[model samples]
Target: MMNPAPALPRLAIHYCTGCRWLMRAAWMAQELLTTFEKELGEVALVPGHGGVFRILCDDELLWDRKIDGGFPDIKALKQRVRDRIAPGKALGHSETAAH
Candidate 1:
């Protein structure tokens, strides 16, 4: 018998509370949840500090604001998460728009 596919990954969005990035972090969480509803197990919003903003999947770091030097574009962020969780999935308009 063939083995079943692995379960979906858990996503964590950590944003700097001191920088007041709650809205930005929450918005990205909402976008990811909406786009990958079927493939994601959960999305957690974590409060952080020192202008830190990061996205992690299954404990692996995906994005970091300090390193990237800015907030991620919504569409680009979606594509990055999709690439990890559901590689074959399409992201509709998010994929077509220029970044």
Candidate 2:
């Protein structure tokens, strides 16, 4: 019998087309995929409307632009994903440069 495949995190970025946030969404996805190349299963870009911009790791909400009051900067975003998927993982310059 074949062993079951390992479960991996799937990330989704939902950005509003009406608000022209696709480039931002795509860029974030690129950053995440490059950062978590081994830890993640997939990253999906989901088109949305009404100024919605969100990031989800599986079913867990990572960021919501509206409720959070603004978009998350790259550093904050990288830290958020790292915290959820690989706690204690160092983010290199992304973690240290600001300090």
Candidate 3:
């Protein structure tokens, strides 16, 4: 049987106080998008009204919630990113759980 196609992913970045953090986050998110494009396909990271945001698999509420550690928390952000790239699988699933 043919499997259903995975839904398109979406990202939303809530507006924060300054552009420094948001800008950095946006850049990092873009890098992630490029890396995951082969698997998860295209992804988006946008700014909203309170903080930065990113699409989880297809969730658009990532921006609504505050992200801990801010921009420096690339590890945490990457985890959330990996979650979207390979929902059930771990980051770099082919190898160890962590990548």
Candidate 4:
């Protein structure tokens, strides 16, 4: 018998509802979904407070706004997610952009 395909990774974006960051979270979700449609199984927006903003892949922390000192631009975010899910994968122009 043939083995089934592995389950794709799940990403969660926890944004501060009190801070009104839902739109930002939603946009990030859309971006990740568009970029990693095949690699990612789902992108969930998790409501949070206390100025929280974080991205996680299968419970692995990818980005933490406070800990990281600031929010990552989409290019950096994509690099972070890609490093977690598909290391060494090409990110086209994002790869060439300065860090």
Highest lDDT, which number?
2
Model 3 spans > 4 angstroms off: 1-4, 17-22, 50-57, 60-69, 84-99
Question: Could you tell me the TM-score of candidate 1?
Answer: 0.89
What TM-score do all the candidates reach, one by one? Answer: 0.89, 0.94, 0.51, 0.92
> Local error of candidate 3 at 98, Å?
11
Model 4 steric clash pairs: none
TM-score of model number 4: 0.92
Clash pairs, candidate 2, are: none
Rank order (by TM-score, best first): 2, 4, 1, 3
Summed backbone clashes in each candidate are 0, 0, 11, 0
Instruction: State which candidate, 1 or 4, has the greater TM-score.
Output: 4
With candidate 3 superimposed using the best TM-score fit, by how many Å does residue 67's alpha carbon deviate from the native? Answer: 5.8
Ranking by lDDT: 2, 4, 1, 3
Query: Which portions of model 2 miss their true places by more than 4 Å?
Result: 97-99
Q: Where does candidate 4 have its weakest 10-residue lDDT segment?
A: 90-99
Q: After superposition, how far is residue 10 of candidate 1 from its true place, in Å?
A: 0.6
Error of 2 at 99 (Å): 5.5
Q: Which is the better candidate, 1 or 3, if ranked by TM-score? A: 1
Candidate number that wins on lDDT, 1 or 2: 2
Steric clash count of candidate 2: 0
Candidate 4, residue 34: Cα displacement in angstroms equals 0.7
